[model samples]
Target: MSIDSIADAIEADAGEPIPGLREGLEEMRAGRSGRRYTPEQLLVRSARSTLGLSQQAFADLIRTPVATLRDWEQGRFTPPGAALRLMEIAVRHPEVVRDAAA
Candidate 1:
């Protein structure tokens, strides 16, 4: 279809209800479906949040590059075993990690 025709059609359907969109939204609101993080992602994000540090600060504290930390948090890549262990310790004993970093 022509661009103008496509635009007109889009405008025409602006008020039309998308099939199952409402149901999907309701399911997400009720905690039935949404972006679910992997355990590793949760660990990395939780460790940073628990320590109240920004990504850069957390990366510095962990002695990893910020990009690598972002990759771990975004699930683009899994952290190495050592990093995982450190984050696990951070989660359980944030004070210890903080003191050690100091």
Candidate 2:
């Protein structure tokens, strides 16, 4: 489609507004971001990144099996419930986790 035609279509749709966006904004205005994430939503690599550790080092520090840690990082498998909980804890308190692991 031509640029002008696309612009016209977008302008027309703009009047309708996106559903729920206003409600979300109001929730945020009321101090609730409405953001929620389960531990399973966290990636293994991200947890390690927050701690500033390499894969092998992170696995060793956490005492997680290297292969299992790799599997999680590679998406070959998601961390199990217990592992996910640990990852959440690690992300939230990297120093404590690191010290305790040590």
lDDT on C-alpha atoms for all candidate structures: 0.86, 0.74
Tell me the spans in candidate 2 whose CA falls farther than 4 Å from its real position: 1-42
- TM-score to true structure, per model: 0.68, 0.56
Top-lDDT structure, candidate number: 1
**Candidate 1: segments with Cα more than 4 A from true spot:** 1-33
Position 95, candidate 2: lDDT: 83
lDDT of 1 by residue, 1-102 (tens): 454454456556786645555566567667796777999999999999999999999999988999999999999999999999999999999999989987
How high is the lDDT of residue 59 in model 1? 95
Ten-residue stretch with the least lDDT total in model 1:
1-10
Angstrom error of the Cα, residue 19, model 1: value is 16
User: Model 2, range 3-58, lDDT digits (tens) per residue?
Assistant: 44544566577975455655555676678866554445455767899999898998
Residue pairs in candidate 2 whose N, alpha carbon or C atoms collide under 3 angstroms: none
